[model samples]
Target: MSAVTDRTEAGAGAAATAGAPVMTRRLRVILLLLLGAQFMLAADFSILNVALPDIGKGLGFSLGNLQWVTTAFSLAAAGFTLLFGRVADLFGRRRLFLIGMALLTAASLVGGVAESPGILLAGRVAQGLATAMVTPAALSLLTTSFPEGPLRDRALGLNGAMLSAGFITGAVLGGVLTDLLSWRWAFFINLPVGVTVLVLAMTVLKESRAERTAKLDVPGAVTVSAGLLALVYGITAAQSDGWGSVGTLLPLLLGIALLVAFYVIELRAAEPLASVRVLKRRTVRWGNLGGLITFTMGSGVTFLMTLYLQKVLGFSPLVTGLSFGLLGVAAFVGGALAPRLIGRFGGPKALVGGLLVQGAASFLLAGIGGGSKSWLILVLAGTAVSGFGHISAVVSYMVTGTSGLPDGEQGLATGLTTLTQLVGLTLGIPVLSSIVTARTTALQATHSAADSVLAGVRLALLVNGGVLLVGALAIALFFARGTARRSATA
Candidate 1:
């Protein structure tokens, strides 16, 4: 009987060992498909930026209407993301993801073949809506599949890296495609990638939803969605119409009022789109604030640098895109290192350290002024360092935000995270652009064109650094207090 038992144990061990590799392979495939989709979505955010000139010229877009191509996408994405995220939780993540991919494919086709501005803008809106569906659904699937701990952290780290890479690569690719091929290829490029991701996702991704389904909160959804739409539209309008203008203030104030109403509705609703309890969690609150700061300051600094590179330094679009390559490489390294750093130092410390590093790097870039090659070196170094810290913070904040949440609520958590990201991205450039525009205009009488531009950019960079430092300090204190409270209970 002892001999028979030993032989059975050995057989079980062998079976388990054989199955391990299969599971590993399966996980890898799933991660690839998900990350591939994420990369495509992120890339779309910046892909058209460099090609905007070509797009406007090709389609005979008026200067007034040209900005709508990008604005339409941002408004739709920001407005619908939270609603779709909750919908994904109630329905199915895989189903939503597949549907999003299909919509993206169709949108890409429409935009690629569009002969008029209206058609292209319509396609952009559809693409934005698709992104709103895909982002949270994909993120929730990842969190649920990976389980909480080192595995999830590592996955999030890679996700952060891919996001940074996608943004930079989109800028580069947009310029190259517009310069070498045609601006239309920028839209066409998504066709094959989207179709492939959609097909593979259907097979690899398992459907996931909340364990206990509830009725959709229609009022909460309507108020929150409309509020976000108005808010984003107002922010974008502020870039051109001035912050004090009726075009900006009307929507901004209305958005704020609607959001406040949504909060009240959620408090009384049977099934809220986003649970107030979850939002009240210390980790979720501070973590999202950190995310918002990092994205806003990071994107804002990049925009300023782009203007400096082009207008001040006289670099072409392609050359300016290439200049950001070092930043992309550093972002990859930061992403690869984030999980290990989080394991060694804990999430809060890692996040604060990243913010500090990024702040210091932005401060360094504030020294950029001359059009000399020496200034180019400063730009490269600053971007590289900032990218590393920025991506590290991104990964850490994501891990921090989603940590300790129930699997059922991962969709809401990720939606909030993605919402902050979109908000930051939408708000960053405009806010900083306003600062630079005002300062440059003020200095134009006293300084040369290059000098005034450089001064404005430098001041903006300093503001970026200052904001990050303040944020890091606040988050550090907040986390420390939370830890002390937990210890006291223990």
Candidate 2:
């Protein structure tokens, strides 16, 4: 057998021992089905990025208002993930997954035809909801389908690769479509992809329903999702509305209060959407914290780079998309290799080592930032390597963090993981953007606005480097040693 085949067999064996259904030949089709769905989700992530300028001009939106295009999608997706995860467990994975795809497809079509920012935002939000529903079910299905061993590892690795590939592919495709044709093509592109994936999924994906008492804690889901939405919206708004403004403070305060209430409700509620017990696992807690930091830095870096390429480097949308291809390739390669790396070095060592390398790369790139210096090659290459390191770290954490939980608790774990990622991305963007904006504004009198922006970019990179280092330290000092192996096979 090929390495992938051998690994799949081992994963099947491990999963069988866990009392998961044996992976039959038919079951393997699930991976194929999932690939298309994952690609659609990942690609849409950066699709609108390059089209921001076009979108603003077309819709007569200010730069500030245009940000809602991205923000709405992100917060909606994050806010709904936990709710969807629980619903999937309660109802059925296959059913929910298909429903999500259908919604995403319809929403994409609507978005493509939107003439106003409000209509576009609405469609994007709907798409986000669909993403939330699809993503967790995809992960949960993989966990249940693949057995615990080499096969499972390979499967997860491939899953991660597809995700990374989709992200890069989206950037390039979105840029090309937007530049050559129109921004509308970016949204319209998902239509055919979604339709194809939906059809394939219906034909190939197996159905799995919760075997135990599949109760959903609606209160827990509502509170948690609403809290996250408030918090993220508040932060994003802070960039425009100012921290002291009621628009920012009210949402921020309410978000904190609602989140606190969520914790309290989870503690007392029977049939909680996310069991409080999962957080008790030292591995789960620390892993999630680490995930949060990494994701935050990762998203911030991407946002900064996207801006820099277009505004500073004078790269057209197509070139900017092409430039980001390096990071995407690195991520794909890293994800594809993660299973072997985990089997060899173990997940703990990989986690710490990856974070450290990523931090170093960020610092290196930041150090090389000067508009006169032809450092794009060096910086891009370093960022790519950093992406590689991050991929391994993420996949290892994901597998280990959810390890050993009862099948019933799997949805909770998925929900928590998604929650952390959402919170991280939500908070990270505005904080970094605000920092850069503040720094640039402060320097506008002293230097050209363009130069000030570059300076701000460099500062943002420095800060991200520091954040990555601190996150690495947290993994090494507080979490890595214990969870490395335990969580993998838990």
The candidate scoring highest on lDDT is 1
Least accurate stretch of 10 residues (summed lDDT) in model 2? 366-375
At residue 78, give the lDDT of candidate 1: 92
What stretches of model 1 exceed 4 Å from their correct place? 1-23
- Residue 302, model 2: lDDT of 76
For 299-392, candidate 2 gives per-residue lDDT tens digits of: 7877787767666766676886788788988988888888898779766556666677777777776765446536678758877987887777
lDDT of 1: 0.92
| Worst 10 contiguous positions by lDDT, candidate 1 | 16-25
Q: What is the lDDT of residue 162 in candidate 1?
A: 92
Error of 1 at 60 (Å): 1.6
Name the lDDT of candidate 2: 0.79
lDDT of 1 by residue, 204-284 (tens): 788999999899999999999999999999999998999999999999999999999999999999889889999899889
